[model samples]
Target: MRTLTGVDSACSVLAGGCDSPVRSGDSIGVPMFVQTRAEGAYAFDESGKRFVDYVMAYGPLLFGHTHPALVRGLDAVAADGLVWGSTHRHEVRLAERIRSHLPSMERIRFTTTGSEAVMSAVRSARAFTGRDLVLKFAGNYHGHFDVALLDAGASARTDGGSGSGIPESVKRDVAVARYNDLDSVDALLRGREARLAAILVEPVCGNMGWVAPVPGFLEGLRERCDHVGAVLVFDEVITWLRLGLHGAQGRIGVMPDLTTLGKVMGGGFPIAAFGGRAAIMAQLAPDGGVFTGGTHAGNPFCVAMAHRVLDVLEAHPEYYAQMEALARRLADGLRAILRKRGLPYAVVQDASVVDFKFRSGPPNRNYDDACNADRTAYAAYYNAMLERGILLPPSVNEVMFLSTAHTTEDVDETLTAAEASLEL
Candidate 1:
């Protein structure tokens, strides 16, 4: 086995020392702690140090890392083949399972990543509506693709995208609005209704520190889309199964014309899906003008894992309640500890996700408020927690997650570590 320093040095050969921008350890100025293996809710470093994991692979490990049942299923699937290069029963069954939970997805299409799902959904919206404009919120991240990258959240440096190679025309066709502010949406959509193709949003904004929509916000969007005849797209890439069985739409009682799902459903595999009413989804290829295809769209291995994840959920619906309860315990414990220390931090939680801002006072209501969190202070806190054997999302913009594998004991351990980390 490679030593931690050896692994760290080996990473230099990779761009930014990481494949994904968000996974770079240096992005947060922390020395990379190399994980050799993970099980349940704990990760072991190269030196065999154990840490209580709260990141949960950015919310895809709903049941936890290397879940025994899921791994066993994957092993069985691998015996047949990874990818068959043709339609298979696994994808068909997975789609049926997803549609059972999200009835709004009357028609479905698969993709290898959430970014592709968003891209296809946007194209389908445009083709179906014969319009050019797409409206997205300031801190909502659909994906890293060109149209979705504008004014995206989840970046530690800037609210605006890097703006490197994105076209000027693409930027012009997109409009950014403030989340939880219906007025902002109305202001941008006032005269552009005729040109609007879709209003894409994350029903629960996870990229900007897990900001939940205010009561009327999503309903207002639904109404606005209805008035404008533009498709309402819910980017549930992060919230999907993690939020609840029905997801954010079910949890909030508001549905969208189109929905994009990823993360939890893939069970850590590279798979995502987009679907909505059949009328709109009909715009895609083989049935309509819009075109979308990928060889790895429904990889057999990924589909098998997805089925296993759903099997667990369907068998034990109580897992959702347990995860949420643990999340509440963790969030409330942190709040109490922060208060005792006279720290101004505020903890926000919904379902199984939790976020703590470095600022004192009210919870974040929008991207700007989330940005107001002190990064320097957060970095210190993050490093301290890591030293105390509690693994957290390295970025202030990212949220912590809970899994069925996590328990009351893990929550207590994390809280104790958190309180001790503050003392450092």
Candidate 2:
């Protein structure tokens, strides 16, 4: 494997030809020739090679690359100003737009990244309930906030330990539990019932692939939080803009007390947000003691782009239907190919996000189950796909994304590559 370093070579080196199977050079991990220009559904390499993008900037390209509408909207917003360090019109408009899309959000606050949004949300929970500790499920990521809670970072130490630089004390304060086990959460909530400030979770886990919460899992969390007076935080960083407008909250109908949103919020731009009841949100900044501010929190460009993106989602409720159909088509196609090849594999999917796990049983139920997936076979398949010009997230843990810009053509092409890649 070749190893290239530095920012300018970030893409070329890591994505060039020298990576390992863990740096495997095929399929989703395939290298682009380094292009100068391109837009929509496809990206160009430095050599001007056109490849359909399945990575989609880690699932933020809901409308695909450089949609003219988004470009024009951003251009208009930019003509007025770039960053005033002051709230622009898009702030109120975007908040209203988000709330309109997700009725559960009574108040919203912008942040520079998903991590900040999660941190602020956790802080709000503590201030609202006057508590300290937070609970999160193993394998369900909610950013890297000190106490915001999360599972293991990389694919080591199954019990989930202090991920390197994380302070020992920080890890100790943040509790972790098994995903899909309401009993585990209950035990923790009861053990620290009154002291529990919040319970953060990804309604549909993205890090270890799209593992949807077990039936009644989210509802049970909601009930437990209500019973203990702890805030229930839905970290929708990956599922936010991609899983319809209201996200998992809307798809599941179990609204969370607070939600941290990221992907697609800025339309490939750096943006994220958190929101909850106004009563709890009032505790931030000038309103309450909890402090949350960033010079670029609500940058005019990000807000403007996000506003336009939301408009696209809001205006076309059927977009998700299309996404679901295409996702299903792609997933079904791949699974059929595998079954025909007698490959021990299955597809775990929810809406546009999907993962190809080389497991024997039903789709994974938890991290333990996900661990059973054949990483070697997956690596081989990934290599095959990359060689076929389909790009995928490097790690098997990362799920596949289908953007709005992708059409039936893309899914069909992907499946054609999938069949060829899995040919062994």
Candidate 3:
């Protein structure tokens, strides 16, 4: 019998040779390397080639692959059980930890994924306000759910319609606004024929690269939501712990009516949460008209992992500082390299998250501006870096992450790779 190669086996079992289409390597025009193991800041492919990982499992492995503390915590918890399918102590404790940092989460409910959390949050907002319309910013992804899948308009003036299978009716109920633009949000809210239920945003845009909110942008959203009685939902799934210990809301000092959290909270496991004012959250069923539940929601194992992640973060405030320092070093080095070569590029960063855009200036404060970046240039850079044993997100629109497990040495090595890769 012949043994199957990694790509061959993956192609046979998984569509596109990867669970997620982004990992397919089609964007880079190269065959994807199948990773067999990952530890600390590096991952080893099937061929035993080591690559420094900057994706960090798309933002969940905050402590990096198979962190010792996380492994020990999971091992201890696994000895106890997997799932009891009932209320557990860990769930309650985890909720308390999250609420301590995000006071806006007066009440909380866990879900199996960030998508579910966002879906439930929208439902609760609609139920609580008895309003049908929800305004979501363009390029600020909430999940693959239909309501959140509506595409942006050809121009900012018109409301975006649904993508493929989503009904036109669903598109009518959802409005698209430009990120970091107060006027765009105000226009939609003011023109509303009926009351708007919620305005969901990514506090700090991550879906369309690592763009941040302009000054007074979030504050303006808060004011608009208050005036129109619309729920302001911050989708902090990617920015939760990546921005800071307390999340983007805490870092920016702008609070929202409801918040959705995931990614870092699970510490490489599957867990997410949605919560807000007790009155608003009370709308979720078992107690209210809005309904949401999952069998694995808040299962002990995921909850235990989440609890351990929070504990580790709380114990080590310096972890944030260290990672931030490393990120700054990397961004600075890359900027220096680009400047020396007289290349037109923009490096946007916030704390441990950074992204590169091939443009002469900073990205304009909207998705349209981000779209103008040179993808061809990025593809060339990505392939070059990958060949040099450095792994970056396959797409230019995605942000690269830094972890506590990364060292100054790792940052230096990445810079060296970037200097060579950018020559493309």
Q: Number of the top candidate by lDDT? A: 1
Off-target runs (Cα >4 Å) in candidate 3 are 1-4, 27-30, 152-163
Clashes found in each candidate (C-alpha, N, C closer than 3 A):
1, 17, 0
* lDDT digits (tens) for residues 302-360 of candidate 3: 99888888889889989888888889999889889999889967776678877777767
Which residue pairs come into collision in candidate 1?
344-360
lDDT tens per residue, model 2, 178-222: 788998877766667888888888898886667888899999999
- Per-residue error for 361 in candidate 2, Å, reads 1.3
Which pairs clash in model 3?
A: none
**TM-score for each predicted model, relative to the true structure:** 0.95, 0.89, 0.94
Best by TM-score: 1
lDDT of each: 0.86, 0.77, 0.83
User: How big is the positional error of residue 388 in model 2, measured in Å on the Cα after superposition?
Assistant: 0.6
Residue 197 in model 1: shift from native, Å?
0.6
Worst 10 residues of 2 by lDDT: 18-27
Ordered from best to worst TM-score, the candidate numbers read 1, 3, 2
